[model samples]
Target: MSLDYDLVIIGNSLEASYAAVKAAKLRARVALVLGETETNTYTEIDRSTFNCLTYLDKKGQNLTQWELNYDFVTHLNSSQIQTWITQVKQDIKEYYSPAILADLGIDIIGESGEFCRLPALGFVIKNRTLRSRNYLLAMGSISSIPKIEGLSELGYLTLETLDLENLPYDLIILSQTPIGIELAQSLNHLGKKVTLVVEDSNILPQEDAEAVQLIQAQLEAEGIKLLVNCPITQVRKIEDKKWIQAGNEALETDEIILITKPTPNIKGLNLEGVKVEVQPQQIIVNDKLQTTNPKIYACGSIIGGYSLSNLAKYEANIVIKNAIFYSIFQVNYHPLPFHIFTHPILSRVGLTETQARQSYGDDIIIIKQNYKTLAKAQILDETTGFCKIITRRNGIILGGHIIGNNSDELINFIALSIKNNIKIQQFSQLFPSYYTISEILFQISENWQYQKLQENKFLNNWLETLLFWRRRWKL
Candidate 1:
């Protein structure tokens, strides 16, 4: 039996569609198993709304405190925002539509399918069998709602089912992920009293503590109650009000939102039958991203962790190389950056301070710089965060954590540096535009140099001796 496609991507998520289009552009015979498309329409709207709120917040205009029913910054109400979101969603659907994809030389099959090991390995959808040389699973994950007493019957909202038009006055959010932190802030800005309950000791345990604290303080200042290390024991609906018993506290709210961990969408895929190792939350894959069955590969949310689009795309690129050709490419997430879209956004790359210290011991150096010290931050009145960089004694950047305005863009500079194995010394020689936020990197690098010099007593003495000789010579 001849192979029908070089690659058959399973799932209708944006990541799956993107992989299909990329494979097609590479001239590979690709087919997309289009199920109900998982559009990120609301996510984009929420981000846009947050940006508007951010502008007002920076302007020192407490719109929420003003009790403004309408967003003066965007000049739009909730109903108008929904209308715009619908149009945007329509546009996105058309862009990734089966017709458009088919025109791009991607065989878009609008049917759900499952892997079959018999009659040769292939995916079966209705009467048709898709036999591909290799298969890629980009099936995105779903919000893994926690198992709490009376929660299912009490009714709650997840990101997938959130309604922006009908937001509650008070809400309880159960999560510890970046999305959870972001939602808490965004909703708080929109005049909703948000109580964030986290099961972990700290939010973003993977990031630098100092950077995370800055964001945490900002959230508290904005009046969003944070209940760390609090696990929900039960949920109940007392008449029209919702009551949550988390840890030692019993909280009341108008609604409850769950942004818990994501469970991979592999239930109907028959992965076990196909000999693909499956975990409760993720699919097991090797460094090469090859599943237990080498003929099949998986990426995106199904692999677990953050489920970031950027990280998924990175894995997808590696999968493409291995599937399309005999390549030894393995996915490396060390240089990849992840960010939270809070007011003073948090972005980080590579190992955090604790991780670096654990691996490198006390030989690692920590460099810190404040956003307020930068002229750019002062001019913009957005100086509420700092940058923390961890490097080996040799100046090799082990990690970088930034919390401030434009940290998302700034962290990329460090990510690119780390990817190219560029040392922190290289940044010291850089002359970023004087009145730019990027100057913060240059300043941080200089601090690293000063710290190194301070650690070298002999060099410091030699510099002092040289200055004394120059003074005595009186040239």
Candidate 2:
């Protein structure tokens, strides 16, 4: 069969739309299959709303310091919040409108479709068959629902379907994921009593334990109830009130939210016919981002890791190249940084301390600097966390975990060092401006140098002898 296009991207996800636009820009004949359902749009909007609300709430406390006499109320009425949501939705729609995409030479298919295998592999939607040299699966993710008895009957809220404008007074959120924690914090700040239930021993199990503990502490300090290592056994609705049997405690709340790891939306696409292997949570792909069927490639939330659009776009870049041309390029996530957008953001890149120890043994070095020590942090009155840099004994930066104001920005410096194979010692040579948060990097590098000096007894003795000789000669 003659190919209909060079690439056929399946799904209406932001990642899919982005790939389509990029492929078109590359001058490849691209067709975007936007199914009836909308994916990731609402989730993105909710995330943006969370960030905006958090920023306003934090800034409200410093109104007097800024010499502003206005009282800042971060809370918005239901209709006002809905209006904001509508405007955001409209803006996103305009940005990715089919008409705009068509101008770039992309075929926009609005109907839902499934993969067909018998009559030469192609996607079938109504009367049309979208045949291409390569297929890209960019289907977005859906919230993973647990198998708790009575929970399905109770019908909990997911991030995509959450009604922030009409949030309940009390919430029992069942999740340990970063998005879950972010939502819990945002809702708590909005005057909602949030009880965050984590099935794991700690939140963000992949992150540094100390940093995770600090975030937990911050949440608790803000009156958010946190239940670690506690799993919900059952949930039942009782006369407009919901009761949850979590671990040993039976907690009552007005609503329950499930914010577990997201599952990819691959149903009805007939991936089995196309020989695509899929786990319960993600689609299986190789380093080249190719599915089991080499002709098919997948990216974004479907392949699974974190539902970060920037990471997804990075993957899309690699996928587009290999799909349109020879499959030589592979996706690299080592340099990319991810962060939870909570107050005193928890951002990280590269390996954690445990991973470094597992890989390099005890020969590695760990350097920590408190945010409170930074003049910028003190001046900003936002010194609630610290930065931990994990490095090899030779000072090669392996990873960085930070929990503090602008941690999202600070982590990038470490990410760049790791990406470029730059040593931690080089950070000391950098001259950051006075009273800046970036000084933490210099302090951490110096701390590493000081640690090495302390550990080197021979060097210490040499310094002591030189000092004594110089004193005796009065030089």
Per-prediction CA RMSD (Å): 2.9, 2.4
Work out how many backbone clashes candidate 1 has. Answer: 0
Candidate 1 deviant stretches above 4 angstroms: 36-76, 86-95
What is the C-alpha lDDT profile of model 2 across 1-475, one tens digit per residue?
Answer: 5788999999887788899999999899999999886665346556766676566765675665576777653445545656776787778868889899999999988889999987788999999888899999998888878899899988888877787777779898898578878878877766789999999987888889898888888899999999989988898888888999999999999888888888888889999998999998899999999999898999987787777878888999999999998999987787789887877788999888989899999989999999999988888778899999999999888889999988888888889889899999999999799988899999999989999999999999999999999999998
Clashing pairs in 1: none
Error of 1 at 203 (Å): 1.8
Give Cα distance to truth, residue 127, candidate 1, Å.
0.4
Question: What TM-score, to 2 decimals, does candidate 1 have?
Answer: 0.92
Q: What is the lDDT of residue 282 in candidate 2?
A: 93
Assess each prediction's global lDDT (C-alpha) against the native: 0.83, 0.86
Give candidate 1's error at residue 357 in angstroms.
1.0
